[model samples]
Target: MNLTQQISEDMKTAMRAADTKRRDAIRLLQAAIKQREVDERIQLDDAAVVGVIEKMLKQRRDSIVQFEAAHRHDLADAEKYEVSVLQAYMPQALSDAEIEEAVSEAISIAGAKGQQDMGRVMAQLKSSLSGRADMGKVSSLVKTKLIG
Candidate 1:
């Protein structure tokens, strides 16, 4: 089943099981998806749905970091829960080694030799690695490869 259909089915299960947290998270996801569809005036494919999920996960990660830094462990934990739920829909994340390999390949493909080429390298990396790796880690790996 497509992501949207799968999510809809899961939402029904969550409701039947009385899983409030899961149900709420699923509703939030549906809202985000619906909002995007309405704004864009187009139906989102599975890839686009994945993009929305990734965007939500990224936002949660940022919120978790900020909350933790501000000594709001409770808020941070809540955001982490949302992140976990959202992650269930994401593609399997790349390992560090895999990210490094992908970065190496991207650098070579972009002919990125130094800091000046960082932008081009990063652009390619974002396109290739979106939803597959943590971009912050990828950026550091690219810098190391380019500078070393």
Candidate 2:
């Protein structure tokens, strides 16, 4: 099944299981997907849905960090749960080694030699690696590879 269909089925299961937190999380995901579809005037494929989920997860991670910095342990913990739920919809994360390999490949493909070519390399990597790896880390690796 597509991500959207799978999510709808999971939502039903969450409701039947009386898992309110999971159900709410799924609803939140659906709302984001629907909002994007409405705004963009296009139906999102699974990849697009995954993009939305990844964006939500990133926001939750940032929130968790900010909450913890403010000593709001309870809020941070809640955000952590939301993050976990959101993660279930994404592709498996690429390991550091895999990310490095992909970065090297991107560098080669873009013929990137230095910081000046960083944008081109990153654009290539972003299209190819978006949900599979953290772009921040990938960018760092690309920089070191190009410079060293």
Whole-model lDDT per candidate: 0.91, 0.91
lDDT of 1 at 17: 100
lDDT of 2 by residue, 33-146 (tens): 999999999999998998999889889999999999999999999889989888888898888888888888888888887899999999988988999888888888888888
**In terms of TM-score, which candidate is strongest?**
2
Question: What's model 2's overall lDDT?
Answer: 0.91
Please give each candidate's TM-score: 0.90, 0.95
The TM-score of predicted model 2 comes to: 0.95
Worst 10 residues of 2 by lDDT: 134-143
lDDT: worst 10-residue window of model 1: 127-136
- Write one digit per residue (lDDT tens) for candidate 1, span 1-75: 899999999999999999998999999999999999999999999889989998898899889999999999999
| Candidate 1 regions with alpha-carbon error over 4 angstroms | 69-71
